[model samples]
Target: MTGWTTANILSTLFGAALFPFMIAVAWGKMVEVFGAAGGWVAGFWIVGVSWLLNHGLGLHHQAGDVWIDMAMAAFVGLFVQSTLAGGKPGKAVPALISGVLGGLLGGLILSIMA
Candidate 1:
């Protein structure tokens, strides 16, 4: 309310409307990259993990916080994709390791940003 302005309001409204479209595009791309189950898992996992990290770590929420969250998400997505791709038990270790690495990288980037 304090910073409300016509331009801000309009932009917010536009962004809200565009958000779903963006999600759909992302979803499609994920599905293409990872196939159906992996894609869905990655998409949902990103949201869940991001929420947990943001709140659990007590990280300050800011406009660019999503960049780090998304980076982690991509790491998770790739892990899921590779795991599902092989459909092998042994792949789990590699997937987890890569995901953890991705998460570490994302955190590092976030720290640098801060």
Candidate 2:
């Protein structure tokens, strides 16, 4: 233990919580814009973003990391694809694509950070 302090623990908690918060915020916005279809699009966007954050942070093999990654991946792969395929292109499609791209970018960011 490297003398973990309150700041360190709180930082960790906040960092971890941010992922879900982002998903909720983005997803809700998407839903508002595109309804169920947008929700689907937002789902993928969340995954891509989450993946990037998780991998970028490169958190050690913690249970929380596992949960976040799994949740994000599932939404991106399943919901995003389905949503885009089901409906015409709305704002959601771009958002979803951006999310995945962002995740990739996040990987690069992590390389620099780590």
Per-model tally of clashing residue pairs? 0, 1
lDDT of 2: 0.62
lDDT of 1 by residue, 3-109 (tens): 46666555444433333433444666777888998677856864554445444443323344254333443444454554566756574778678868987997799
Model 1 CA deviation exceeding 4 Å by range: 1-4, 41-114
Clashing pairs in 2: 44-76
**By TM-score, how accurate is candidate 2?**
0.41
The segments of candidate 2 whose C-alpha lies over 4 angstroms from its true place after superposition are 1-11, 60-114
Q: What shift in Å separates residue 79 of candidate 1 from its native position after superposition? A: 31
Supply the global lDDT for candidate 1.
0.54
- Cα miss at 107, model 2 (Å)? 29
